[model samples]
Target: MISFHNEGGIMYRFIFLLFLSFQTNAADFVHPYPSFSEGEKLYTFPDFLNAHYYISYDSENKSASIKAEISFKTEEEGYPLFDLKENPTRVELDGKEIETPLVDSPKKETKFRVMNQLTSIGVHTLRVEVPLKFLLRYTDKGVDSAFWLADLDDRSFLENYIPSSFENDSVEMIFDVSFKISADQQIFANGEIERTGDRDFRITFPKEYTSSSVYYHTTPLGSFNERRFEIKSKVSGKVIPVIVYSKTISNFNSYEESIRQTMDELEADYGPYLHSSFIVYDADLSRWGLGGMEYCGATVTNLWAVQHELFHSFFGRGVMAANGNSGWIDEALASWRDGGYFSNQNMRERRALVLDFPYVKKTNRLAYSYGKNFISFLDGNTKMPIEMKLFMKSLYQKKSWTPITTEDLIVELDLFSGNSYQQLFDEYVYGNKSTLDASELWIEPNSSEHSIHRKISGEDLYKIL
Candidate 1:
């Protein structure tokens, strides 16, 4: 996390980074992503597309083989594009030589596979045409990628492709995945892995996954165990099971205690956590980034970034704001929760940030100013709590499980708070107003300076303002 302060004592900002680290042991796979089930069909969008993969690993040669199951919905018949790295040796499609197109200036691997002439639609099988070593090289970033073989030291298949879109109206598909690894190495995936042999395991997706990318990490650092939490929601009409992937097994540990507290607070405040599992990784800071990215039912976060990222389960992944502008709502709300709702420490740090950093001139006030101001306004306004609930509900009503824009949120705020958000926007967001008038609330100042500095408790601040 980075803190900025300004000499003018006008504005303060704390900019946080996505921390990365390497896992020391196998952590229980926690669903950092949102997931849901429709009828007997389970569905989630981890990224943008629906992907199913079968992977096998060979310990003797440090290699792996993969078969992908893919399905895309279109009004007309068309084939999906399979752009791959150049190292694959044997290429086949249902056991035949398929001509691969070579494009100039390939991003990673120079080759691409296109089934431009598919005779059928729905489910299609994509078998590897080349050797496993080539696919491994591509997934491992030429074997020199950072965090390669950090924990498991075994060969694995990882999907790195981005999905076309993340809308909620898309169709869902299931993944039937199986993997073979060395007897000594452990494997993890989206769902539970059922072992069939000493060297092979299979993972079945109980729901339709969203992302086109699948990730596999091979390390030798620590061990993992599976745990389940049943979440009964008052808002949604489902009992979601939350999976926890924790490196620590003991409940008395501080890490576990922190997680429990955070979970309790978040569940009490936000809606139920809608995932089968969540992963708590005891990883080194240099490997995976600071916080975890939300996957349908899985999230990857190091210990340091857990609380902040967990809060994101509600703000970022659950009620996703629109792209490019939603970063403010997602990040700032998470930061506020992590910092304990602008407690004394938070206020001190925020005051310092204003007095020490360059926040007044920042162009992206949506992220820095609007986020902080909304939090502060919520602290001050008596109607804020109910208004916030209504605001979130309005977002769901308007967007219907899709990402929404800031303008959408502003309208929702107007409806709930009975005040034009444009006025607040002009005063705080565009005009850069920080401190509210203490006189309006009948608060007496002990001393007057260029800026007012006082210790305000979270509860007192809420009541006073």
Candidate 2:
């Protein structure tokens, strides 16, 4: 939907140069721009084909040794750039060591560009040795931080500490992680974990075709309870490994059953579950305001909120949006799946909330509420229930790991509903024009039975709404 054609202006000419620099042959390159204010700065994205990360952690010193090898193909005539927070100790291009690691500092960016040496346009591999310092913060059980390693009567990590490339599309990234800790420590990764020695361990994840990020948790031995189970896919007859990590072992079986049921319902509504495994971490977040967040195939939340985060596997992380503005595409679908809106009246309230704040750029209340309401209108009023299912499955299959824009979603909606979503989108979504006519939007009130099919408690539902 984004065009970088020749235009007679300095801005257009600069953009054209950036387009040339961001070329990729892996797939048709779709630039995800025209986002919020920060959108204009993101002129390029990595067409990441494959990557391998070797991480070594020293719990005693809180330092890390990270070595990464990334293979990608781009049609850009100039050097490829990467966003790395820490400076690498060594850099290599296509198995040859460059005399100096070319680091270009553009104005007003937290990221430094890794200059590439591409003599010709083809597949090339870049290797770098990244030194991580104090990336781990020690905290107590009450603290709810993304990446924390703590010794609160026990030493453990909250995972999500691994430094990741910014906004890269999903690809087959092989990870080989090694951790050195106390003799009685255990490492929990999002990948298949294996114990190689007394104080050494390795976790290798399968190629994630539906996720753009990878993460893991490391803890002292026996610090947390672990339960391993499996869920059967009726569509593929494949059984997937499921792991639960909780501070206590109480009611783990019930949690597993709930997770299984949620997966079953989602797989039935959508297609088969995309990942080979799923993990739930019932983390103690008594202090942090936020309760839950979703990772690639793993989640950090309480036992009761497992379904909400699991649904994210199909929406948030499974099918990525282009930017924060398009984040509603995932958040709204996930909220609807969680029964955030149950009736046409509730949909009206959601629309009113969006109309109240028409120009908020970042993902906030408007994104979730309006998103759920819009989908509810389509499914309940327009009565495209069957097409809705097909559209979701097809969209998921096509844009599994790639980021899609609002325009991209409108195209899909138009194809499914056989109607234009421009007016609705402009009013409620992209443009925030606030000129949508609700009387013309609704077709009929949904049946009471269909309208009140909420699963969560009224109290929790109200909180989300």
Candidate 3:
């Protein structure tokens, strides 16, 4: 009897262990930073807070140097990573020469090694000094702006400035940046101004936040009227104050309603608005093709691209993508959401933009097509509601920490749909079969083309004809 009781106790313990393992696996979301092995933890800031900046530009050499200092409180020792302009001639951290890895081409990143030995568990300082003269690559078209110190290049604009890492505790960060730029140009950055003097401006983040960028132009531009709104978080009851800056006063009115409506819809869909404040600044008309770039809470966009950038707050800024593969996930989701809104409003022209994925894929053939088509398929596939939740959970748990692939989606579909994704892939992606019978799926009897109807709610309608 004693032996039997002991065996029963052992069985109970084994079952408990299995239950714990499942819970741990389910809870895993967002990849831990690479430094986890180095005894570091990771945390993300809210989407609406903008990092403060202070910059002073030098006009003589047409080159700029910067000194950035950010303060954050933490329980465990952590490090900072700064994406530097490729032309950096010299970089000094805490007055010491530190080795920086050549992580990618045309974009250079340097990691500052915080002294964990002497540093205690509390507040820390990260000081970075950069010399930008080395970045100029002169071509026949004069100084190529491609090498400009602040250009985001291929990565998301936020990653360009902040060091993404693992952290043990939450902390507020304040960034004080000083830059030297051409005297003829005007400079702008994130947040409400504390002061502006001596060809330099100082900005402040009202809450805990991560990165900042400087915008400069040679020609002086007149300021437009600003529009403000207060967006409240449904979950936290926190409110995010917003401001929109434009070149012409009239342009502010054009984008105000769209921005407000987008924010309303986003907060309704996503968990909440994460930042204490947000800003949208006007960019040069000539550089409008670049669309908008996301920083912490602040985004710089052209007049026409304001709506698309606003949606970034939910996907791009809120749910961070670790690598290139998952990069398109947020972008495609945002495009669908923003574009779907127009379609629902009976604006067929605006809705047509969402259907033009084929043309976009053709234009950028090398880019990942899975994100675009996966979203479309999700709309058509009934199991997607459950699958997306499982997929996102898996994505967060797998901690792939980089971009995801089409195979990842297939695995997810298999899990949620309880059917092999091979059939779906062959029918939709590989063109081996058709999604629906063309003759039966037409919206209008006279229309020749077939329209495949999506099974998901909140998806745009389709009529191939």
Candidate 4:
């Protein structure tokens, strides 16, 4: 569980880290992410939620609708905050109808739905209905639609179409997706799909899924062509299936070997791939090169960015970041892999990745460049025989599904390397307290990270999809 700490008007979620004489009990925590309740008032969320969404899409009219029934058990009197960017068609709390007033938070710069009435400490049920319009764009022969959400903004995860909770709570999300599409089509999701009826699917995700874990993309069969293949994981030798899809072009010939090599190396260095299968929506990513978004087991990527995005399946998507402040760890590791994982004896003169305020849910853009340099420094300079990479492999195996903080990473490093890395993190990663001579520092290029929002434009979305 998290307690709020207000300093200089910014509230921080203080996670109970294991530094004391006694270790914190395992069953007392939801998640370690710092998430603000975007309602009229701040509400403590101790409710574990499971949501089932019945979604129907009509591609001819470019419209859709979603009805979500969420069940939860509350420890105390609290508000069950769920976000649906589109004003919900209807909202029900415990089978009683409630007003769907849109709460606008200029501080968070988003609008979402929240329960106005607080519930008594017990199990509760909530229902939300939302309409999705104009989300489909027709191709010449087929149509293209994606429930695409990168961790781009405060309100951009699974909450866009279906009713979704915050990052701090892992929920089981079930999607009953039905289509009124005329063209023959198939749904691409990170979840396992079972065909229930004609043009209907029951997509069920793992019980331990958070907000940013699911990947859902839909298009006409010929609008995008796919090549399905299998690869043996390095650690477990588990035959993992991979599907690469593109806009009616067979451009995955050269990428097959790269994908195999990358997956093998990743599993060898880290552990088994957590995602049951991998799906790559290789949209060419040409409008801007070296940019893709990482989902749980799937990615939307190109040749140049394939390795970096796939590396995320282990670190970013697997060993998850609990909050935006902790978001630098994966980007740094992925970028370090991208930039050849160069270990440097000398530390670099770089800015901090964790900022001072309003950064609880925002990934620092400099995480790509400066963050990688710091990781390289850690990899090179360790008191123990093993470097930071080995520590990460162990961390991945231990904390695959658990969301963690930057402080947690530092503490783990301290324990693994048997040397204190806190001051280094304080001086370099969290605060710019170290002043070094420019000539003595290692200099890496100010390279952009692999994110579509930072690398591409609004016009590039359609092209990338």
Compared with the true structure, all predictions reach lDDT values of 0.38, 0.54, 0.39, 0.71
Best-fitting candidate, measured by lDDT?
A: 4
Kindly provide the TM-score of model 4 when superposed on the true structure, using C-alpha atoms: 0.84
Root-mean-square deviation of every model:
18.1, 10.2, 14.0, 7.2
* lDDT per residue (tens digit) for residues 31-150 in model 4: 532335644555445444578989887767766788889886554455545577777878888889987566654344355565777776556788888886424565544456677666
After superposition, which runs of candidate 2 have C-alpha atoms over 4 Å from their true positions?
A: 1-44, 59-62, 94-120, 134-168, 182-184, 194-202, 209-211, 286-289, 340-365, 380-390, 397-402, 432-465
State which candidate has the highest TM-score. Answer: 4
Which residue segments of model 3 deviate by more than 4 Å? 1-54, 58-63, 69-83, 87-95, 98-127, 132-152, 155-173, 177-193, 196-225, 229-239, 249-251, 284-290, 339-370, 383-465
Better of 2 and 4 by lDDT: 4
Model 3 Cα lDDT, one tens digit per residue, 103-220: 3221112232332222333334444455534223222222211111122123222333233222111123343433343322223444445335444445553332222222222222
Candidate 1 — what's its lDDT? Answer: 0.38
TM-score of each: 0.52, 0.69, 0.51, 0.84
Model 2 lDDT, residue 206, Cα: 52
Sorted by lDDT, highest first, which candidate order results? Answer: 4, 2, 3, 1
